[model samples]
Target chain A: MAAWGQRLAGVRGVLLDISGVLFDGAEGSGVPIAGSVEAVARLKRSRLKVRFCTNESQKSLGDLVELLQQLGFDISEGEVTAPAPATCLILKERGLRPYLLISDGIRSEFDQIDTSNPNCVVIADAGESFSYQNMNKAFQVLMELENPVLISLGKGRYYKETSGLMLDVGAYVKALEYACGIEAEVVGKPSPEYFKSALQEMGLEAHQAIMIGDDIVGDVGGAQRCGMRALQVRTGKFRKISPEFTASPPLFC
Target chain B: MAAWGQRLAGVRGVLLDISGVLFDGAEGSGVPIAGSVEAVARLKRSRLKVRFCTNESQKSLGDLVELLQQLGFDISEGEVTAPAPATCLILKERGLRPYLLISDGIRSEFDQIDTSNPNCVVIADAGESFSYQNMNKAFQVLMELENPVLISLGKGRYYKETSGLMLDVGAYVKALEYACGIEAEVVGKPSPEYFKSALQEMGLEAHQAIMIGDDIVGDVGGAQRCGMRALQVRTGKFRKISPEFTASPPLFC
Candidate 1:
């Protein structure tokens, strides 16, 4: 183990980002990254607690589990964490019926939930369904509702897909925000509460666990803000890390 | 004519806004305003040069002429001007093939133009077609094309529709601009060049022309900036004209 790797030897729990670090979208069929399967196998052999942390709002939790398992990862449904559960909790607690502006692939996650007479707008990357009619409806709802809330799954600007870097939910979310004159409560990575909750689920302290991911802002920056050590991989959406953002610099794994 | 209307009698040319002034969308189907049709007829009988200037990117120039004529206005296609023609002209002059991001209603305007291997993005009110896939493609093209130009039909935030004030192209254009990190060149009303061109085409100087509209910003504000007299009608999207914006105030007609 390298010096940074040796420092992480005592880590009891590992939080890993699925996309870019473990699986590359460019590989088609969500192929696992080279050596990531072995790395995960070794972690499993060591009997360390592992959780796959992801901000993919396009798919449901069950779908994510199936994809990860098919890609040769020893991950279960319980071991995967995403923003949907947290978002759902918030909606229920606040008594808000969300008009989900998410992709069709993930709409099943909220199928059982009440969305009629929606007073809240839950936005994610809706792909081809980000139509003008839907957006206008959301805007009209915001205008008509008193103190309407907007919940964002993630604020990622772009994602690396099979083709190339494509815009995520951030741009479209910002458009709704600008037009409605409201800000969205982000529910995914980079939120300290979200990271802390994941750590708590693993029965580990922030300092005793390490996070591995490709995205600097959503993973490294977020994990570090929660006082967890982070490792940044150069596989997906990793351009060049700036020195100014090096306070909790990820150990390049 | 009212006392305010008398002042515009000496005006050699009239630059009129279509939406909210001559035609009201609140009546659903682009219905003409009360008495406005006869008013335009009187102007036509007087042989006063008149041009219908609009920022409605939802329809084509030919369609606008047909609608205005159906509403009892004696107007020709040549007397109608919109952002689409100006945008098309710019695309042709710059030798750029446009990936048009406009409404299906107006897409027919560009059917005769070449759009293969698009090097420019022409954005308008692309109602319902503003999908994530299309925006990502535009962003990618902007990143890949050498000096890719982004042309906006208008930077309007909302338009008074039959339903209510609905989201316009401004929000989407701003979103694309934010994601791609580029500013779009607006080609519609409020652009001083657009107003000046209308006056030139009418064979009249800006000072000798009078502009009339309901929109405070896109109509009155734009014409006054071009050194033309303006009239603010209380029909469409016009609220109370603030004193702060009264330096080049339009005559309330």
Candidate 2:
């Protein structure tokens, strides 16, 4: 057997990052990576349970799944564990109303939550809506509350797009954190709870699952911290080998 | 003599913060603080030289001086040391053209500098202009450079206005810094060079001057760090007593 195949012998389940692993794009369009569609199908054909874990907050899960399907990927909304749905669940569980600073495309995801007289600030990839007015409004809402709550969807610094690299939600989250002198509660990617939830959905232990992703920090490092074996791919935002990744280089790439 | 009087016995010059000390307002109008205008005249009557050192980047020095003069302050444009004018001088000295991310009110301050093809990013209190497009543009410019340079007008987290406390340039600067993985060069308050320049203009050393302002960090702490005796005021953004101010409470509050 190959080195990768030998390593995956004991893995019962797999968590895959969608953006850089399956496909990479901005807006509603995505160009599937070469052989990625077949790769995902092949993984599903095997006995291993599969889950798509993504930190994408710009689109609704349904919209994202539809986009993936359009590109001939065998994916479903139920199998995708994204940040928006996780954030919505967290809001519902805590009974917290959020003043959302997110993109227009994902607004429907939070339609069920009460937003009037918001007690907390929920920030995501706002895209062009990350204006001074919106940010200031979110800041004011947090400052007015006795105990300020800022919930960030994801904490990626920047993401690649067709145009170029663009600022992400984490950068704006840091801005609010600095201005209000408070740390934000992140709900996606490297959050231990997020990773654990995905594992629980698969009905598998952390050690039983393996993660394949392009993001070093959010995916590989996050899954590794959760006791899962992780593999990095050099397709998307992988610039160079970081200190943390030096020990375990990308096996598949 | 009293404790404060004894402390000020050797002080040859006074560096006064304009916004919170003399008046406080938002937009174009300002309401002068009670007895502040008369206090300025009285200070000038004494032997101590006085200079208005401000981090007000939303407006030009001419406009700021005009507003102060309208409020019965015995002041001129030359006696005021503001961030915008100082930043322009720095850009010229370094021979770096900047893509300005500042408010429209202060745009004229950088008229002399070449901005055709920017080599650095200059950020300030952009007010409503801190949009996603503008910030992303600045980020792209910085990322494209071999060595990114971000020059900030002031590093204030938040400032007070008639409406409420609003986010300042420092918060946005932090956003850019985190996104680009680079530290910004602050050209305003708390910067040793800015303070020294104010002192040099007034023909006084750091030890021979006293700083009186409302902001604990920007005005009091910054001046203190530059070896000057600093006093805090209980106006504007001053909240509870911080650890750094425990030993030196606001003498004039």
Candidate 3:
């Protein structure tokens, strides 16, 4: 067995990051990464449970799955643990109506949640929707509430897009945090709750799964913190080795 | 003499903060604070050289002076050290054309400087102009530069407006800083260069000047850090005693 295969011996499930791993972040429709289709097929052929965990807030799970399918990846909406759906679930569970500061593409995911009289602020990768009016409106909503609840989709600082690296929700989240003097609760990758929920959906323990991703903090650090074995892939956003993973360099694939 | 008067005995120049000290941050033309008009007249009558040092980037220096004149302040454009004019001067001195991400009101301040092919990004309190498109545009400009230079007007987290506290340029500056992994050079209050410029206009050293304002960090801490005596006014944005000034609390007015 290979060294990586030896490390995955006890892994019962596979948690994969979609964007940057299976496909690069292009303008509209993403181009599937080379061999990612074969890799997904190989994973499905195995007895291990496969789950696609992504912090992609720019598109709906269905749309994302459709895009992946068109790009020749064996991905389904049911197998994905995306931020919007996870956030919607969290909002429904807490009975909190949110004034969403997210991309228009992901708005339908929150259709079930009441947003008329918002009790909290839900922010995501809003892209061009992150206008001052929208941000101030969200700020006003958060300020009006006695106990402001700012729920961020993910806390990635920046992401590699086709144009170049673009500002992510974390930067805006930090802005709101500084302005409001409050911390935001992140709902996507690196949040232990998000990782745990993905694990629970797979009917597997944290130690029973192996997370494969390209993002150093969001994917590898997050999964590792949640007690899951994680592999760092060199494709997509993986520019260089971070100091955090230097000690355990064998995890890189 | 009172303790504050005693502290001001050696002060050769007075750097007054316009918005918070002279008047509250009302919508249009600010209503003068009670006794502020009289206080300005009194300062004018005194031997001490007085200069208005403001981080107000929402309007041009001329407009701000006009508004203050309307609200009954003894002021002139030459006697004011506003961030916009100071930033324009810096841009000219450095021979760097800027792609401005500032409020439309303050655009005239940079009219003298070349903005055709920007070598740097200049940001300020853009108000409703702090949209995703503008921010992204600024980000793209900075990313394209070989050595990115972000010049921020001020580093205030938030400011008190008539409605409530509003996000300032600092928060957006931070967002850009995080996105590009670069630090911004602040051209307004708390920046030693800005303070020194104000003092240079009065022909006085840092120790020979006094700063009086409501903003604890921007006015008091900034001036104090630059070796000037500073007094905190219990007006705009002064909610509680910051620990940084607790040791010398007698400076409050």
Candidate 4:
């Protein structure tokens, strides 16, 4: 396919992925990828509007900004977007009171939201708090509710962690779907609205924006499907996407 | 399709399903289906051999017997067979120490076996104990191990419980399978070996045996595939199996 640097010659906006492209999961957000910090600094100095988009549903937006800043990336809270805030908005608009199944570290993200006698189940990567009791409670809620709703922050099958590529909330989301015979509402990457929202905030048309990330499906393919150009960095767990499945390889950066 | 009683004319042995056929989940094992008790009594009086085979891996064999006896069915611990004991035997034979993911009530079933430094993950219906922490631990164990094995007691999608047809361990088992990219060895009903083992124990061939149960897939289809005749009872959640999918309708009793 086409190359990234040449296509970005006239791009007005950039949507960046955090975990793999900017920093490796092995170093816990401390280690930046080679030239990534400088790349961000250069982009900030340029006229291009930049937005940092991540599928990490475990942490809040503030935490992400802090993490990125710690790795010497020029970012702000307003410029960083994750699945948690969008998921919470959907919960409110749908008039859903959610039984939050998420990590304790990020529960504060839902601090302002109502959680009493929840009719819907909102699941995220809850780290140590994901227990059988919580899943059963969610299952029972679905069975009991006439119209039960299951909202998953991100449907990522797995993610790179310090140990290795670990199982993510997508597996649990699928389990609940199989058990309850209900479909979950994914509120993160690959959910077209997530990309549309970020593009809308940047005031850039889909044609002017490019998504840069290491993940093929979530970042590269998702953005391409959203009518934006995509750049797949060779770093991190990047696999060569088959041409039959995708429009083209994300312009390799 | 031929009727059940007429087709059983010369059947040497009969495999029976427990829940929904003999007992109701709502009644807490105290209530029996209409004439089901006397039916079992009549079967006991006849020359036909009988064995109760179930995919209910949550309870031990003794508990099943006690529940059956409480419902006025003529059943002994030996007459009732479940996946737990057979799965334990397989685990031992394979020399795989398992990280058992099951309910606390049934953990006693695997008490005799060693659970140290487990290389395999054995999952059953953990009920309230099926938490994110336990599933994640199992996932982490599978990731860390050189060759991890996943053994599911039964791959039933759901089972009748007091609340309703609650989620079964199969859902969680499938979740793990999806996340880890591994197939689980299902050790319970619908598995050919499970049916073969029961028939072997009765000293009868598969062709000489008939299976009677409410579930179309687990009981009827499973038995019929193993060369045994199947009887699908109209009681409980019985649905008409499409002619194309099944050999013929089990003689509706």
Candidate 5:
């Protein structure tokens, strides 16, 4: 199956993670790694279903797609999938939109979340605009509603910088649960069901995609678990794995 | 119980991830989160069990304690437990690790899997480093042995980046099986027996020191199905939901 790269002569489908594989982790701006753009273009020419699977809770796929295109990459918003968007799915299925911890970076994604309705989905996040006041507001709605819940605990750090990674606002939402008492609903990777959901968008077997990323354990490890061929590209921050660190350890601990 | 965090003034046993949260992803440096020192101090001042847990694949509780101290967690590694480390408990008791996958990440985690000993303790996911060649190595050994399989699809990003959220790597490992056209062993989460192996740790009940990760559907959700009050943290990457994307939501599709 993996022979597709050699047999078909280009990646037929790609489950690319943003920030590391493609971008350098700027909030939304980054240079594609050497050979990454050409690699993507080659895949595109083959009509591969190139989907961007990101843990970034900050931006919508549409917005991210535009940014990627502007950055001289062939991309589309429909090709993007993220955790923040999972809230919309749970709400529709359960008939409950409860409350949401969102980011100003991707607040527009909530347009499908029905935030304007007086009794519709609630809004909450750890963005600079977030506050105890906003959390309290969400708390009130949660306490008052028959079934109040959270869209997600935005613990993902989608876009990164060179210095280090930051909390993926979802972490703040998780903290809110400790801040309060009720547990929030979640819908992202690490959650295999969420991966199944993402797979639905790709129209490919979960086993067919190759997850290429910079994070060794996060990107490569997770994909390996879900039954996909994963490549740990040294293109991102994880490459700094102390070259002294055993790449091919003998009798590993 | 969570209200305790409210009534109490200090953080208790800071729940930590094995690799990145405590140790660096590649086993390089133990770059702990900032405030860890103060959190430990505060927890100590508050008089709490300095307990910790991890998803480590290469060490026993004793080895992890040493590593934790070496990494500046200031806690005994004996106080820590990796999900895979407990495999010894089961294999020693049930007398089978299954020769299926033949491996998992971190060889130290599975002390019982002796490839030369005609055992069932299959070693599974070693990472992208785990591939067809490795599977063939596992298979060559397996064809000669006989026992239930031990499949190790390392779920979620085993290696991570400073940017993207955690992803699963099992997809590739499973792909190996697809390519090899054979079934392997099973020895990880959702393996009901593994839970007992963990419970045996610290002689605690399943109610004590439980793992609270994402996957209300997989880990938490399934646990609830198995009679457990799972706290589903919505922090992982796939938390968002859009109503339009529901399986039946024509708008989403």
Candidate 6:
């Protein structure tokens, strides 16, 4: 831990991804399947930013924070961001009653659906319940309407499990538009709003924080494009971004 | 338009992006913007699947198809799909009622909000009506309750408009989860279910079809990983993925 901490000497804070960087995206089991817990604990003890963001829309920050605490790290919900809650914020801010366009796992977010006007917010996620019909409706909303906005553009890759496979919202957004005639305006990931939001929350300028993640777009490239130094990890599905990266690449793998 | 179309010839099908690809994210502009209609027409005459997909949550397939036809493209509504419609199919199939979500322009799709249970499905699309009050209720349903599902893992980039910068559903998804404890289950891009669904819809075997898009994980890499030939466009971000395909230091780029 000391040696690893020293590697990030000048780095003010570290933006870590939960699944691949900290935990191994597993539930009903343990925190990690490898040495990730100890590694994360070491990072936290070193007093880094330890901010975790993920394209994963499965667990809430609170849920993840509790799970992480049990695993070994002391963290709070403030250090995380998932897709579900993000969409809700936009809908609430707009004051529109939206019909949920998502799976059974995420239906609890919107308790009320207003019908004064047909204008509503559309939230897309990666879940088991995503089907053609849902996509059809999403397409309808994106294409037919004159002013539709997309929340994020972080592309999700398929995370294979033993039972079957599921989609992340990235694909759903693309597919919906293909089926519909509208195009959604994305707000997350490579978008500056998300980066600024993170910086604003941490009380640091973009130059003050170091972004880290398993993905090329969200972690490495996204940060670099937004004026932050990035440290790519070998954890989670990190290999997909840089498949050629073996034991290490130019920088810390 | 003619020159670009000529360059796009060998590509067989053009999997155009909905946001900046066609009308430049114009909502309710009334008619197609000049060459957009002509470009699409030439592509359609060339027997291409001028397939369109967007991250916008504003319109419907029927409307888009009608609009495209009005703009002079040989298109049909059956070929479209949006997040709202997709969510509808998933929820209705399993006999589940979902909490509705919407963005600025996609409120029309959720004229019917199904909430028969405490499990809320958070659907997010880009529209003028999405607001903060909506986020509050969604947060309550998700955080207050245990394991409440929040759907709508949105995707797409942000569009700069005259009024201001607008967000898509994907970004909204992230905000919702940031406020609440529950996470959204994503169901787009690189999700095998969606890939399979597309293949099934075409009545073509996975091996026989080729998927094309600009994103790596969602288009090229996603499809390739799922056992399909993939071609990624040079445009958009992630240029590092296929940087200067003219040479090769790595096998998989």
User: Highest lDDT: which candidate?
Assistant: 2
- Provide the overall lDDT of each model, using Cα atoms, as 2-decimal numbers: 0.79, 0.86, 0.84, 0.79, 0.48, 0.53
Candidate 3 Cα outliers beyond 4 Å, as residue runs: A7-9, A25-28, A92-95, A144-146, A240-253, B1-7, B24-29, B92-97, B112-119, B144-146, B240-253
- lDDT string, candidate 2, A135-251, tens digits: 999988987887899999989888777667789888999899998888999999988898999999999999999988877778888889999988888765655523233444542
| Every model's TM-score | 0.81, 0.93, 0.87, 0.79, 0.42, 0.46
- Give fnat, all candidates: 0.65, 0.79, 0.68, 0.70, 0.00, 0.00
lDDT of 6 by residue, A35-111 (tens): 66666667778866666665555544456578778877767777765555666676678875554555444455444
The digit string of per-residue lDDT tens for model 5 on A54-171 reads 7665566677777778877777767777766676666666666555545566667667654443333334333444443344455445434444465563334222455333334443
Q: What pairs collide in candidate 3?
A: none
Give residue B11's lDDT in candidate 3 (0 to 100): 82
Residue pairs with backbone atoms closer than 3 Å in model 2 (clashes): none
- lDDT per residue for candidate 5 within B54-74, as digits (tens), equals 444433456656655765666
| Model 4 vs truth, CA RMSD | 5.2
Task: Provide chain B TM-scores across all predictions.
Answer: 0.87, 0.94, 0.92, 0.89, 0.60, 0.70
TM-score of candidate 2 to 2 decimals? 0.93
What residue runs in model 1 are displaced by over 4 Å at the alpha carbon? A1-14, A25-29, A43-50, A202-211, A220-232, A239-253, B1-14, B24-29, B42-50, B111-113, B163-165, B202-217, B220-253
lDDT of 1 by residue, B135-251 (tens): 778877776665768999987766666567778788888788766667889999889989978987898998889888876667878888888988777766544432223433432
CA-RMSD of model 1: 4.8
Model 5: runs farther than 4 Å from truth? A1-12, A25-28, A46-49, A116-126, A130-132, A139-148, A157-159, A162-164, A215-218, A237-253, B1-253
How displaced is residue A130 in candidate 3, in Å? 0.9
| DockQ by candidate, in order | 0.50, 0.82, 0.62, 0.50, 0.02, 0.03
* Top model number, DockQ: 2
Q: How close is candidate 3 to the true structure, as a TM-score?
A: 0.87
TM-score per candidate for chain A alone: 0.90, 0.93, 0.92, 0.88, 0.72, 0.77
- Which candidate tops TM-score? 2
Residue B34, candidate 3: alpha-carbon lDDT: 76
Model 2, range B28-76, lDDT digits (tens) per residue? 8888877788889999999999999999989988988888888889999
| Global Cα lDDT for candidate 3 | 0.84
